[model samples]
Target: MATSVAKCFLLSRCSGIIRSVTLQGKLPPVCIRNRNLLSQCPSFSYGNRASDNPQDGHVNIPVDRLTVSYSRSSGPGGQHVNKVSTKAEVRFHVYTADWIPEDVRQKIILYNKNRINKAGELLVTSEQSRSQQRNMGDCIQKISDIIAKATEKPHEPSAEDIALRASRLEKRNKERLKQKKLHSAVKQTRRVYFD
Candidate 1:
């Protein structure tokens, strides 16, 4: 069973031709990259983060905190896309959401300045999938991805790391100066001396 799952994962990841793979009526956990196909497999689970800690690296907005509305999707699905309200639009007050960490809220505000409105609400939308449930999930995932990106911090350079970078920079400067001196000598030789 594990091998089958691994094979399915590898096939979907490696081959762009194979968007989804169904094995024995069960879909592997390869729906993350292509979230539009998430509706076809109800059993497949993406990262359903529930914790509030930003340091933990995942943030899941409580259902109550989110205000979701559905509209007709303009994506591929032919007649179904035109008739059904599959597009999901989610909005939440970033400043009022107590579940998110204060620091993370600040970061979200900083990173997503365009997404946030004057009322301090973060708006997210998804029309990638034809299914309403899948589209809603996609909207949530988009928000989570944004929050996760904001949560990441650049690693502080250690003493050795800093010293090594300084030495490499010094070496590059010396090489540049040597090249400059050689070029100046060549230009001097080209000049007609008026001795």
Candidate 2:
């Protein structure tokens, strides 16, 4: 009987049909028609031994690390806005965030010192959206943008920049020399010869 039910379940699963079948007083788990479809899903499944290093262009700042809060937004809205808390505030502890690299952490701290509080928490707030979820998303996005900007290395002077600066300096020097020659020539002509 179990074998027959298993066969039916397999056949149904392959045929993209969902049918409930009882086996030993328990219904078999529903099987998906396309097993590979899960790979196309946006959510990713991480392994137990996943690397924490973000050097592979993958930032591992989990949502759990951020502290999220909501409050009533003070803006131009009707009674619904007054009653509902739509503002979202997200706080991230820069000093304690182990996921961020040490160098990047220092850069974030230095670059966003004004935003960071005494507790070393970086605070970001969003109240543009009327919905709490949307405000929360905006807050998270703002924080992520700040972190990205902080982690980015400053644009160093490239070869072209160096060349351009040198050329500008050379041009200024030439202009100054020409001005000086003109002034000297005028001064010589103005010199009264008391013969």
Candidate 3:
């Protein structure tokens, strides 16, 4: 029975028809079909993982190292918004994360001091999703993306690059002096006391 069910799922997914998917549950298969179709009809998928962090394990956020919680959102959705906790706050302690390098950790701290609390944790949030689970996923993905960027090493300018910059600066100074002389000549032309 399990094998048959798996086969059914595989066929349905290949054909891009979610209607045939069903588990041995009380919910009607038609209801599930409708729900699946509705979910797939959306333009965006919350499950899309784009993080480059190696420790994320292909899920963007390594859920084991992250904490995500929910709170009620204000405005719109009437009672549901005020009553249910749909806002998700994702937090990670950069100071204690074993996977992060010391330099990278300090960079994150210095760059994200506003988001980091006194305990030196990086916090990201998402209240845009109507569902709490989706919001949490989005927040986790965002934090993961940020940390991934931070994990990469910074590039340094070479001696040749520095000399090129100095040459550019010298040219710029010459241009500025020429511009100033021209400006002074124009100003002198407008002077009535010029002999």
Computed on alpha carbons, the lDDT of every model, listed in order, comes to: 0.61, 0.60, 0.55
The reply for model 3, stretches above 4 Å from the true place, is 1-64, 155-167, 184-195
How well is each residue in 3-46 modelled by candidate 2, as lDDT tens digits?
22223223333343422111112222343344344333322111
lDDT tens digits by residue: candidate 3, 1-195: 222222222233323533221221111111112334333332211122434344432222223455556678766898789788778676778888766656667877877889998887788987886775456445545664565556556689999999999999999999999999999999999989736
* Alpha-carbon RMSD to native, per candidate: 11.3, 14.9, 11.6
Which 10 residues in a row give candidate 3 its minimum summed lDDT? Answer: 23-32
lDDT for each residue of candidate 1 in 54-81, tens digit (9 for 90 to 100): 5655444444456667777785788897
All candidates' TM-scores? 0.67, 0.63, 0.58
**In candidate 1, which residue pairs get closer than 3 Å at backbone N, Cα or C atoms, i.e. clash?**
none
> Given candidate 2, what's the lDDT at residue 169?
100
Ten consecutive residues with minimal summed lDDT in candidate 2? 18-27
Comparison by lDDT, 1 against 2, better one? 1
TM-score of 1: 0.67
Off by more than 4 A, model 2: 1-52, 177-195
lDDT of 2: 0.60
Better of 2 and 3 by lDDT: 2
